[model samples]
Target: MAEKASESSNSISLNTVDGKIFKVSPTIANQMQTIQSLIKAYDSSRVISLPHVNAFHLSKIIEYLEGKSATTVSAVKEFEAQFMKDLSLKQLKGLLIAVGYLKVNELLELMPKTVAKLIENKSVEFLRKFFGIVNDFTPSEEAKIREEIAWAFDGVDED
Candidate 1:
């Protein structure tokens, strides 16, 4: 009986990369499918490790998870808008990918808006550099990508 009780009780701790342990509920853990499967599949009761997610990002994700669960929808949206404003493009991309994987709706909604602002009114060179996209295409292909999004690229300075 004690073994069974201990087993059930041990499943909720999430180990982040910076050595922080997040004692989350199984139901909340289930909200992250990646975490849910790892928990369900693992035999041990020790903390589940999240290597890809660093401490800062993990803490933010936790805040997002807890915030959404506790707050009103409008409040969550407002917070997300403010939150994305402070994050760098690299952090934004990471957050976008993480939030996308976690299936958190508010963060997911903010990603496109953030990306649009970063790329809007910028040159192709800026877009390429911002996204770390190498110019694999030939000059013809470059012309094509630009011609394809003429409206999106219109009125932009040469880059």
Candidate 2:
């Protein structure tokens, strides 16, 4: 039946905030909670507009979803590691926001854990530099805060 044929079709179009369109399979689109909900609420043929996610992040998320179904666990792990390695901090942050918005649980966990590992044992100055955060505290205020948490600085890994 034509209805059955149409029901079996898995293609879904996702329109990004910047107007970039990605045609993805149901398996890939289902990886995103937001997209999955949209598909469930509307026709699969409809172009689901994601107002918050950009094309670059959406593409990367799709890439991740596509790679996640690898036959071997090691292959998936390798792909995920390489994917994280390929992204800069800024890109990672953007991807994290997109992943969070899309409710990609695996990526949400993996990305934050990766970022935490990168920042682990790093000094406050190093964190400030890596995150591009300005230290708004005055010297006295900083010294007090540092003194309160002096133990955090001890045993830090060398940069």
Candidate 3:
């Protein structure tokens, strides 16, 4: 039937926020839950527009999907490590947002762990700087909180 033919199409087109279009196989598109839902709701033969995802992030997601496949488990671990390492802090944050928006389950699990590792054992000051969080507390308020939780700061890594 015509409906079955459309459903079994070779590739689906994705239109990014930056106006770039990417054609991806159903396997790849379905890996992104948001896109999978869109595919189910709309005609798979038409281009799916991602209003929140930019071209760079979309391309990175695609690259990650393709690279993770067709590799041994150990090789996939190495690939994931290298893939995360290659991204700058800005890119990592941006990609994490995109991954969250797309509901990519693998990345939803991986990225938060990676970010946690990045901040683990780091000082409050270092964390504030790393996340661009302003110190809103007055010096006295900060001193009071620190004094109250002095035990929490013991052996904390230096900034």
Candidate 4:
């Protein structure tokens, strides 16, 4: 009976897609809504498998959760800034997808805003290149679309 109680109270184990295991306190696990639901549905002692989350992304999410618990809001804000800045574009996209899947609310809010800021004031060509989107329209078709939506291009920054 005591062992059962202890097992229920133990830290949650998470297995990432890349096969790395992470142990997180209940407090941290509850912050991720997906993991929280999984914990509720299964025995807490069982390892929760995250098929969509890789080790790097999981580590970053855990780091964000642990780092943001600072005593001061300013310190947390600073930490969040540095965290976002440290990720490359590829890393940012992967982390954002993982955060979305895990339903990490704070990161879901922060990452999209960070992405918006990155592409803000940039031209369409720059955005296409930034996102690796291939332009499929021929020259005449492109010209027609541009003419129709000229207002959107009015204040676009040069590529």
| C-alpha local distance difference test of each model | 0.70, 0.82, 0.85, 0.86
Candidate 1 residue lDDT tens string, 43-139: 6466788776666676677666666777797798777677777788788777766766666555566578879877777886888877778988999
Each prediction's total of clashing residue pairs, residues at least 3 apart in sequence or on different chains, is: 0, 0, 0, 0
- Summarize candidate 3's per-residue lDDT along 31-67 as a digit string, tens digits: 9999999999998888989998998898888888888
**What does candidate 1 score on TM?**
0.71
By summed lDDT, which 10 consecutive residues of candidate 4 come out lowest?
A: 1-10
TM-score of 4: 0.80
Best of the candidates, lDDT: 4
* Residue pairs in candidate 4 whose N, alpha carbon or C atoms collide under 3 angstroms: none
| Top model number, TM-score | 4
Worst ten-residue run, lDDT, model 3?
Answer: 1-10
For model 1, name the residue pairs that clash: none
Model 4 regions lying over 4 Å from their true place: 1-9, 123-144, 154-159
At residue 55, candidate 2 shows an lDDT of 87
Show where candidate 3 strays beyond 4 Å.
Answer: 1-9, 125-144, 154-159
1-159, model 4: which lDDT tens digit per residue? 111122445888888888878888898899999999999999998999999899899989988888888537878878989999999988988898899999999899899899999888898888787767899999999999999998886677776
Which of the predicted structures, 2 or 4, would earn the higher TM-score when compared with the native?
A: 4
lDDT of 1 at 74: 77
